[model samples]
Target: MEPINLDKIAFQITLHGGNSKDLAYDALKAAKEGDFDKAENLLEEADKEFNEGHKVHSKALRSDDKENRIVPTLLLLHAKDHLMAARSEITLIKELIELHKKID
Candidate 1:
C-alpha cells in the first residue's frame, strides 16, 4: 500500500518516449526510401518502446502520485511532447504502409 515516486516515473517515461521517437524517425526515413521492410521493423521497435512508456503512465495513474503532484516542470511537458510525437509518427507510418501497399 505504497505510492510510486513521480520523479522516477517521469524519468523512465521520458527515456522511453525519446527512444520511441528516434525509432519512429528512422522508420519514416526508411519508408521514404522505399525500404518497406526496414520501415516496418523500425516501427515495431518503436511500438515496443512506446508500450513501455505507456506502462509508466499507467503506473502513475494507478498510484497516488497523480493526486500528490507538486510543481509542474518543463521537462515533464517535454516528455508529453515526445510521446505525442511518437504517436503521430505511428499514425503516419500506418499511412505510409498503406500507400506502399497501394503502389504495389
Candidate 2:
C-alpha cells in the first residue's frame, strides 16, 4: 500500500474546514439582513465544503486503522480543531438563521 501523506491530508482538512466555517458565518450575516435565499445557498455551500473536509479526515482515519496506528502531529491536531469548530459553527449558525427569520 502507498504511504499516507499526513501533511497533505491535514492541509486539505484545514482548508475545507476553514472555508466551511467562513461560509457559515457569511450565511448568518445574509440571514440577519433578511436575505433568506442567499443565506440558504451559502449554508448549502458550507455543508458541501464541510463534507469534503470530513471525507479527507475519514480517509485518514481508515488508513490509520488499517496500519494499526498513526502518529499524532501538531498539524493534524490543528486540522481536527478546525474540523470540529466548523461543524459546531455550522450547526449553531443554522439555528441562528432560523431564529432571525422568526424574529424578523
Question: TM-scores of the models, in the given order?
Answer: 0.75, 0.94
Q: Could you give the C-alpha RMSD of every candidate to the true structure, in order shown?
A: 2.8, 1.2
lDDT of 2: 0.95
Per-residue CA lDDT of model 1 for 7-104, tens digit only, reads 77678888998889888878878877888889889989999999999888776665545566534457666666777777887878678776876775
The 10 consecutive residues of candidate 2 with the worst lDDT sum are 63-72
- The per-residue C-alpha lDDT of model 2 at residue 53 equals 99
Residue-level lDDT tens digits of model 2 in 62-85: 888645578979999999999989
Per-residue lDDT value at 80 in model 1: 65
Best by TM-score: 2
- The global Cα lDDT (0 to 1) of model 1 is 0.77
Stretches of model 1 off by over 4 angstroms after superposition: 1-3, 65-74, 100-104
Model 1 misses residue 49 by how many Å? 0.5
Candidate 1 is scored at a TM of 0.75
Cα deviation of 89, candidate 1, in Å? 2.3
